[model samples]
Target: MNRKVIVTCALTGAGDTTGKSGHVPVTPDQIAADAIAAARAGASVVHIHVRDVETGQGSRDTALYREVVRQVAASDVDPVINLTAGMGGDLVIDPANPTVALEGTDLVSGLERLVHIEELRPEICTIDCGSLNFGEGSSLYVSTPDMLREGAARIRELGVKPEMEIFDTGNLWFANEMVAEGLIAAPPLYQLCMGIPYGAPVDAGLLQAMVNMLPEGAQWTSFAIGRNQMPWVAQSILLGGHVRVGLEDNLYLSKGVLATNAQLTERAITIVESMGASVATPDEAREILKLDKVA
Candidate 1:
């Protein structure tokens, strides 16, 4: 077992989960506070996704992202900032024609999706490595090869680490090739996203197979959704990788108890400690990640 692990708190996701739980951070201030609170609770990094305050839906606005980063910078805690560059790839199709793009479809060039990342230049950003039917609807998320190549190249120029988001085995295959082709930097970071709809199933065997396929010396983390969230913490650690947690992936501290970002992080700390491994601090995490400097 790896004695030291990095616990990243994905403070807010672009999911329609705000109505389901009051703890999900919506406003910029709330999102930054959640990141700081998670850091205090033992998370070395914080993954962020801004939401529209009025609609409580995901947004790719640079203004909202600026405010969130500003607030976190003002705070004493300096947890590594990870901005979600996974927006602007939604592809909702019209059932009748298949050729017509529906209302929810928000496809844009890969560079267009990186507007916020280009401006904020956070320490880390996410790039979904492949396209998939996002959920149980007409919605699909598109990230084609050409898009990935362009996005990865731009991210390299900005000197920010791109956390490759792999939703399935095929996505992993493509990610590995991106690294091989030098589109992604060496020691690429991969997020083994599990338990999402119509993608890779959240099972140990699948996780193991994905892990086995990883390029040598790759930095990796994994998480699952709903009740499986907490269990995957131990699973990731046992597999010699990091873990992520927060309102984005789960909302409950227990079956009936709702949880805050800090509470969820505190719980993750308990699991890591109980397994005889210590959690890494922010500075330690930067070193572990081989980051030359923190933004």
Candidate 2:
């Protein structure tokens, strides 16, 4: 096996992990610092999602994204920046009314979601492939087929590579359809988002099934949330796929132990090396992902 695996460190995600983890970076400075540190530690790419500093909740404000991108780009450490365009599509419908959305519903147009990507023009951005029941509750992430096509088109126009995020088999199917429709560029980059509630399970069989759904010549990575994060690093690389890790997907280095983003990335590198796979450098990752050089 050619032992070169790319490592993508997802910084603080949009999830509510602020009070849970002591190392989740809330402020722009902290997030940027952690990103740089993860790069130095061995991550070739850093996936970012900024949070409202005051509330530690995820925000789609372009200004906030600009600051995060600027800080990461201007820093001494250089890693390919991948901003998330998966926000602003969450829909929490009221069970009682069924017609009215709940207070937590945040629905924005596809164009509105890409505003930051337009301004920053980061080398890469995420385009969620399809929607799924996020959990057992009434919450459903609303990434309709039309929305996916629109977002993919806009990202392509902006010269940003779209990392198709697939959380289930249907999402993978939709991703293939997107490629067939010419919405996504050739050799589509995919991220198998496993272990999320109501999504694909973290078991090997499901992971392999999702991988088998990829189009020919596709470049892909796989990650699991929470406890499955670290283990999936080994699973992904072993399956001839790439790996992603960070505090965003997981908060613990071990049982009852909180981990920083850098620590999570370092652990991933260790796993790769242990399996006779070398961690790809930032430049190597750029070439593999076909990202523009870091500015």
Candidate 3:
């Protein structure tokens, strides 16, 4: 078993999860608080997504992002910040008129999506490597090759690491191509995203195939949504990659148990230690991922 696994807590996501669980943090203060608590609970990093405080809907407001980053920066616990630059690519098309943009449509220039990342300059940010049919709805999350190039190049210029979010083998293929093309910087980080409908399914064999497709010397993490979240943690660690967990992915600590970010992180640490491995501290994680530690 690999010792020194890095645990990343995804504080909140751009999902309609807030109404389902009271434990999901909404306001910036709550998000930051939960992030700090996760770090204290043994997470080496925290992935972040801002939501409209009043409506509890995922948002792209840079002010909200600024505040969340600011609070996390000021906290005594210094988990590496990883902001979601994968917003604004959402497109909810209108059935009435296929030509018309729907109410939930959020397509924008890739640079627009990075406005917050450009300002915050977090140690790491995400770029969804490919587009996919989001779900049952007519919605699609768009990340074409041209957009990927722009996002990857911009992230390179900003001196921030891009978490290549691989939703499928094709996404992985293009991500590898980006690496080969020198669009993305060296020591690339890939996140094997699974269990999302219309994306890669959560199967051991499929996950293994995706893992096998990773580039040489690439730092990677993996997670599955819902009940599979915790199980996938062990799968990822055993496969020689880091793990992610939090309210963003799974809501239950157990049957009828709602989970907070800290609890999820604590559980992941327990799993790691139980396997005769240890959880990596932020500094160790930084070294492992080849990140430049912030002072």
- Per-residue lDDT tens digits of candidate 3, residues 109-143? 88899999888888889999999999897899999
lDDT of each: 0.92, 0.88, 0.91
Inter-residue clash pairs, candidate 1: none
Task: For model 1, give the RMSD to the true fold.
Answer: 0.9
Pairs with backbone N, CA or C atoms under 3 Å apart (clashes), candidate 2: none
Count backbone overlaps in model 2. 0
Model 3, runs deviating above 4 Å: none
Candidate 2 wrongly placed segments (more than 4 Å) = none
Instruction: Please count the clashing residue pairs in each candidate, in the order shown.
Output: 0, 0, 0
| Residue 237 lDDT (model 2) | 88
Residue 81's lDDT within candidate 2 is 89
Top-down lDDT ranking = 1, 3, 2
Which 10-residue span in candidate 2 carries the lowest summed lDDT?
286-295
lDDT tens string, model 1, 251-280? 999999999999999999999999999999
Task: State residue 210's C-alpha deviation in candidate 1, in Å.
Answer: 0.6
